[model samples]
Target: MAKVSFDGTSGFEVPRHVAIIMDGNGRWAAARGLPRGEGHRRGVEALRRTVRAAGEIGIGILTIFAFSSENWSRPQSEIRDLLGLLRLFIRKDLSELNRNNVRVRVIGDRETLSDDVRGLLEEAEELTRNNSGMTLVVAFNYGARQEIARAAQRIAEAVVSRGLSPADISADKLSEFMDAPDLPDPDLIIRTSGEQRLSNFLLWQSAYSELVFMPTFWPDFDRTTLEQAISEYARRERRFGGLAAAGT
Candidate 1:
């Protein structure tokens, strides 16, 4: 689809939270006759550009699926490269993000992360903790199933400690146990590379999210593609399991 511009339009509304499944770096590199590592490096660059574009367009919350828990099973060298890229992003872009009032957060388990990566994550989160601007949430070593399991554990603990009954547990209350309980659920999820499956990104939060899947690869995804996705999102009549305008 061709890119669409905001063009000072009044009817278009920006979603409160936008989550993305960034995929197809390897395939993109293969098609271009480039190394896989090169593809990842370029993907990181695209991520930076996308972040800037989102901030420029007033995106409130951008949750990017960076490294999943399943990613750890990849070649150790590739994982090392990804970690190096992450550390580089923090060290190099922390100042830029702070200047733009972009708060950075990693919503994944840190126990498996190397000490250096863990330290960098803490530093980035703490540094941007005071920022009130757009929240950039990165899912590294994150699994939707694991998150739900952890939430279940917390809910059980609450039931025991606060004298709450199991029958009283609700979906809304269960959400409080997940990471970033205060953050609003994702309103839209854009998956590049035309993938239709969620791939364990955000199981609980995307119940009503409008998904925009495009054929473009993750590294090829830029501001223009983002605008197109936003336009499609605006045009869709999201009824949240109900009827749309024609039905009404």
Candidate 2:
């Protein structure tokens, strides 16, 4: 991916990759005296809108935190509802996404998922595998710590099986074992509902990502909200731990 830095003279440039932590669905529902499921449904709609807007704005990749491994701790009924929504979203939106030339990629531990859920995810990826447009990454049943641990285990296994030297392991080598090594690290990460933390999303990949937090809930997110966040991103200087340029 090409670097998108602030030129300081030309118009602002769009990020090559943007990741979002869709937060506050339950809180949004609670504020309106509705069930949490309703907020999730609306959040799905917001997701659709965001994907379209990202493509229109020339973003190369967009990653969404759809579900986390820790989400299983929620009420059983709520868990079922979330799963149902995932099924519904794929069934209804998969065809449209494919027609729009969107390539879908799912990352997480899938061994423990039900057969049906796993099938749907695979179908989405297969159907859009040849797409050359924007890539949409869904982090379902994901935990950053778990991902790193899994990579470490794989590296250890390689050393035992292939005689790979333990001393050969480096940060770059470990990254090659991550779920999606081809995708670039996120240039910007946005969280809605005023949240200020990463919440274990993309820990290894977001080392230099500019974060934008908004008070608007997930269900209320739209293209305007995304544009606002990108506008904020354009004003900042990214040194990446180096000294700033000679002049502002």
Best candidate according to TM-score: 2
lDDT of each: 0.89, 0.92
Cα error of candidate 2 at position 137, Å: 0.2
Q: Write model 1 residue lDDT over 30-87, tens digit each, in one string.
A: 9999988888989999999999999887889999998999998899888888888888
Which residues of candidate 1, in runs, are more than 4 Å off? 1-11, 245-247
Q: Poorest 10 consecutive residues of model 2 by lDDT?
A: 1-10
TM-scores for every predicted model: 0.94, 0.95
Clashes (candidate 2): 0
Write out the backbone clash pairs for model 1.
Answer: none
Compare the candidates by lDDT and give the number of the best one.
2
| lDDT string, candidate 2, 1-248, tens digits | 43333334445689899999999999999999999999999999999999999888789999999999999999999999999999999999999999999999999999889999999999999999999999999999999999998899999999999898989999999998898998999999999999799999999999999999999999999998998898898888898988789644
| CA displacement after TM-score superposition, residue 20 of candidate 2 (Å) | 0.4
Q: Score residue 175 of candidate 2 by CA lDDT.
A: 92
